[model samples]
Target: MLAVVVAVLVIYKANFPSYLYRYRLQISLSVDGQIYTGSSVIEVVWKCGPKIADSGRCGPTLDGQAAVIDLGSRGAVVATLRTGDTIYPVPHGAVDAVFICANAFGNRSTYEELPALPHLTGRRDLSPSNFPRLVWFSNPADMTSAQKITVENVANVIDSTARFTEAFVEITSDPVVMNIATKLPWFPALKLAQKGKGVLSMPGQFQLVYNMFVGESS
Candidate 1:
């Protein structure tokens, strides 16, 4: 009976819908050795009901692609993504994980065989540079309901044919929070907000893609 009760509760919770999810992330990267690491804080906010779900708008959905290329050296382009934990279901409570990806170039047999450079400790919020900030929105027409911003920092190192660029982005504000109907029939409707950021490092060129999805009410 105890086991059956626990299983039933789990099933009940699974049906609940989370309308807003926010991610707080910090990342570091190095171009010389091709190393990247990051951590994230995930939040689940205000839930909505079937009426809103049927309308085809619910919560924020984020998706994008980024790449780093070194034009000076042949076969020196490496793009990687490392997430500490499985990012599904957006856990309701606080959870932490360590994420890192190592890329090997030249004669290196494998990423593990790459030599470590203790002297190449990556820096955060480095001096700004002329590197351009590029962003693409999946659905600009639908984003009229919410507010967004992008804060970026870049460091550039140039020597001979190679130029290394590292970038960090911070998004701190969203003025127009989404107000949606509640999933629970009794409680009044509530508000939901979402935000995101990213980091990248490369020897030649770097590109950052930002996408934001917002729910709207009629």
Candidate 2:
């Protein structure tokens, strides 16, 4: 009976984090005076373990702690690293390199709750003050000097005509969101793709909406 109980406890510890912390963030982008639209999906899988090395090795081996951002038809961004740490996904082909070098989680997770995007909560006016900063470079060579910019700047940096007139994000995960839930070491990588007239936002301007959902992952 003792051995059986121990085994069950270990199993529960290993599986609960994966069950409770996985999340999917869906984003839609639109520019002023444009009918076209852009979209991207970001999925983060959290696991119960020590930590993952940059080599993307070790730990659960399947569905490990990592962030995958799918930019629709454009391409994808993948990062396997410690939670809340910077995520560096190698850029390939036409995909420009994007790095969440700072404040990936917006607000840190505490013992009582998971990390939350406080800047996006009930925000009517979106600007650099509220949006997390990121770095983008067209040529990998420029990575050394790429300055941190708002998530909205990504679109304009890619194309001049493409400027984000408006944006919306939908995040679904276990427990509550915008407020808090479970905790983890780091969050996930954030990337954007273009489809409509332009990108998502400009520096210190416009608005980005958010809809947070708390539920079980199917």
Candidate 3:
């Protein structure tokens, strides 16, 4: 049963729009001596809301980059790692970023109120929602060589963490994406400001493999 679901997920990944990403989340965690992997996919609304009007009036687009992963609960495909949340801000946001990486469910299962109930293999008859599992915001315009070092260092730690084997996510880009990497040690933020883009893969045999896009929201 799990295999069928996973297979469907793989197909979904291949079929999502190339310009606009379908939300995709990949998580791995170690509980006691057990290792577990989790993944989900959903449609993301990257329209930037009413900011873009038919008349040409538009809100300033956000300029930021984030390196966060599922600390594990559940959201939908492509809708998992959001770039701009209420707290993260959209345009003219902060520059210095703070990376907070973790295993999808490394240690946060105690709060599930209904763990006792049967798990829903498929959310039958459910209305899809939009939200991010984890996200960090930073303005590339404000990044310093120092901040870059910090971001790289943090990414290293998370990738090498005892239980966080590998992480995955999907996002949208205005311009066609140019790079994608799943195996590398450095955070490929490419300077989080406007038009900045690059792949951010994790380190070691287990890497992050982030997709970097240029231009705007697709």
Q: Point to the candidate with the largest TM-score.
A: 2
Query: What TM-score, to 2 decimals, does candidate 2 have?
Result: 0.32
Colliding residue pairs in candidate 1: none
Q: What is the per-residue lDDT of model 2 for residues 97-192, given as tens digits with 9 covering 90 to 100?
A: 011211233423321222233222221322333232233223322223233334446555544444434433333333323211111111111112
C-alpha lDDT (0 to 100) for residue 31 of candidate 2: 31
Q: Write down the TM-score of every candidate.
A: 0.20, 0.32, 0.24
The TM-score, computed over Cα atoms with residue i paired to residue i, of candidate 1 is 0.20
lDDT of 3 by residue, 1-218 (tens): 99999998877644331211232344444434445554443322212222133322212121222222322322111112333323334322212111111112121112121121112121211111112232221321211211111222334433344244445443322332222212111334532323345444332211122322111332
Q: Give lDDT tens digits, candidate 1, residues 128-160.
A: 221112221222222222121112211222222
Q: How close to the true structure is residue 95 of candidate 2, measured as C-alpha lDDT?
A: 16
lDDT order, best first, reads 2, 3, 1
The local distance difference test score of model 2 is: 0.29
Structural RMSD, model 3: 19.4
Q: Candidate 3: where are CA atoms >4 Å away?
A: 1-19, 48-162, 170-218
Give Cα-based local distance difference scores for all models: 0.26, 0.29, 0.28
